[model samples]
Target: MSASIVCSALGFRWPDGDSVFTDLNLLIGEGRTGLIGVNGSGKSTLLRLLAGELTPASGSISITGELGYLPQTITLDATRRIDDVLGITAQRQALAAIESGRGTEADFGVVGEDWDVEERTRATLDRLGLGHLDLDRTVGAVSGGESVLLALAALLVRRPPVLLLDEPTNNLDLRARRLVHRAVADWPGVLVVVSHDRELLDLVDRIADLREGEVRYYGGNFSDYEAAVAAEQETAHRLVRAAEQDLRRQQREMIEARTKLDRRQRYGQKMSEQKREPKIVMGNRKRAAEVSAGKHRNMHLEKLAEAKDRVKEAEEAVRVDEEIRIRLPHTEVPPGREVLRLSTVELRNGPVLDLDLRGPERIALVGANGSGKTTLLRTIAGTLAPVSGEVALKVPMRWLPQRLDVLDDRLSTIDNVAAAAPDASAQSIRAQLAKFLLRGRKAEQQAGTLSGGERFRASLATLLLAEPAPQLFLLDEPTNNLDLASVAQLTQALTAYAGALVVSSHDIPFLRCLGITRWLHLDTDLTEVDPM
Candidate 1:
């Protein structure tokens, strides 16, 4: 396979002079590649550089053909028509003009050979599960997931040789995610996708792990890459252990050498003080002994230094996947305790239904893109009034929206949590924040300056450490855009929560990790469904 995207000596830095990549070189060949890394590791930055959306501080990018990019945040003008977004409004107009016998030479030239562009566009939309959308519809009329699909459909219609997608499956429901997975699987050209969706990643031909400003390729899907990494980590751990043992041994030997030198010096001093030989001969012997001892001490010191260096190098090879350690005993509800109740409730633009939650039930909300999962969550949380119904909460609740806007941007992470728990002392809040991996300077940093992972952690800490100890939690698309490690950390934190959870998300793998007790499908109505 020939290379489709080539980056040479690529370097990029933020305006604040924080370098993301330096002297990075990469070559992506003709196949689907999943680009994965922790948040702020520059996976999305690399994609933007490849798409020419961002200029590199130093280096060059060469693409074999036309490049198409779908950014992580798809912001389309509300007034723009779908045809305009697809770049086919002019062709469609020209075709209509020719059919009405009002076509000019310029219109004919624009139409060229794409007379069937409308048909092709419709087919692409259908493939992406957006067939309900019409070319004349405004961008604002669709859901967020639909907007993403629309952008992807535009790329498919153009049939660019290189396609770059950043978090493409985010905000999409399961059905839409499947559609994207199919599209990625069937892509014939070079496709580089930056996504945290494991299911979507499993469809790729290879995995490109971007870490420490370098890209390492694994010859398979996400699972294969994970297995390879696990093996490498096992070896790394073994090497660290061996290096540590060697370091300890070197320290012991150095200590023993010092002890022997001290004993030798004491005996030599006694012999010289006792006048056992002529003063001149004794002085020369003492000088020779000192030289020998010095050489021995230096040799041991050098060995010890070498051993410490080896240990440091070996330890650096290991990767750290920190887990969130938190215990919320106060949030636990007794068995059979009523946590929440919705009596004949009509959700805003959603289903009308009655629901009851007891104890610590973990419910998974599933639906299509426009199926009103988010609306239902908001309604349950009392942020949005239902059309006509009653929502009664027996216990305190907290809502974590997909946008993660719960934190005050201007407030420090610790202060944000303090705002949620005004009764808690600053020391107590800092202790809790440390469990969420926000400690010391990180806890003092403003929410606006935190990275994606750090922001999510801070937002989560605010919720999980809030006053009143929430017993019912409503989380909407909680795992969107989260890296695998952050997802794991989230799982760890949520696992420790002894509260009722109503989570709306399309990520099946993450839902499974949550140990969901009940699965609810939101559509025309809310219905209990089997685990997916």
Candidate 2:
């Protein structure tokens, strides 16, 4: 494959003096590449650099083909027509004017070599599941999923040789995701996508893992990468064990050698004191013993040093990802105990819903974006009131909103958690914070300055440590922006949570992993169904 993009000795730093990349190098060839990494690991930054949206602080990037980028969040002018979004308004107007007997040489010039702009636009839109949409329809009339598809259609019309997509499947329903998958499958140009969606990743030709400003390429898909990493880790562990054994053996041998040399020296001193040999002979024997002992000690010391080096090398080869382990006994609920009840509960402009939650039942709420998922969660958390209904809670609750905007930006992580649990001692709070991997100075950093992952941890700590501890949790899109490793940490943290959970998410895989006892599809009405 030919290389479409190359980055050499790249360096990038933020205005706050935070360094993201230092002397980073990469070669992205012609293929559908999947870029994945922990949140805040520079995946999107790299794409931006490739698209010429940002300049590198040092080094250079070379591109052999035209580039297009689709950002994680797509914002379009709602009042504009679809043609405006597709970048074909000029040509469309020229053709229309010519047809209306307003023809001119300039109009013909405008439509010169390519006069099928509208046809191509319609074809691209139809292929992306927007065939029924009129080109003159306003952007506001389309759903979010439709808007995303339209954005992609615009890029496809440009027909750039390289396309970059960041979290393209976010907020998309299953059907929308399928449409995206088909578009990705059929794309013929070089594609670089940064996403956490497993299904989307499966469509890539290879996987590029960005960690700490470095890119590590792995052949095949996510599953293949996991297998390769696992195999490597297994071998590393074996090497570590063997190296440890070797170090112990060397230590034992050194001790025995020292003991033997000391014993021989004492025997020689005893013989000399008893006058068993002549003075000259005794002196010669002592000199010979010293020379031999020095050689032996030096050899042992060298062996010991080598063994230590081996141990260090072996240990350095192993990688262990850290995870948070928590214990929230207060969140546990007993069987047959009512956690929440709702009768004639209706959102302000959404559907009416009735529910009875008991014990630690895990309920999954599925719906498209703007289907009132967040509104319902807010109502359940008592942050929003229903139009005309009653909501009864038998236990305390906490809500993890999609934006993770629970913390005070000006407050440090420790202070945020402390504010939630004012009665708890500082030492107790520190101990709990340590489990989230925020210790000492990290815990003292302001929430506003933390990275995406760090801010999430701080917000979660605040929620989990709140006073009058919550027995029910309402999480709205908890997995939206989390990296895979952070997702794993979240699983570990939630494993210890024995509360009833009402989580609204588009990530079905994550929900299934949480052992959801019931699944509810919230649209015009909330109905129970088999999630699988």
- Rate residue 376 of model 2 by lDDT: 91
**Which lDDT value does model 2 have at 135?**
83
For candidate 1, the 10 contiguous residues with the lowest summed lDDT are 1-10
Q: Show model 1 residue runs off by greater than 4 Å.
A: 1-3, 77-84, 88-119, 132-142
Residue 57 of model 2 has an lDDT of 98
Question: Candidate 1 at residue 209, lDDT?
Answer: 87
The residue-level lDDT of candidate 1 at 177 comes to 86
TM values, all candidates: 0.92, 0.91
Give the Å shift of residue 405 in candidate 2: 2.6
Please give the lDDT score at residue 465 for candidate 2.
Answer: 86
Clash count per candidate: 0, 0
Number of clashing pairs, model 2? 0
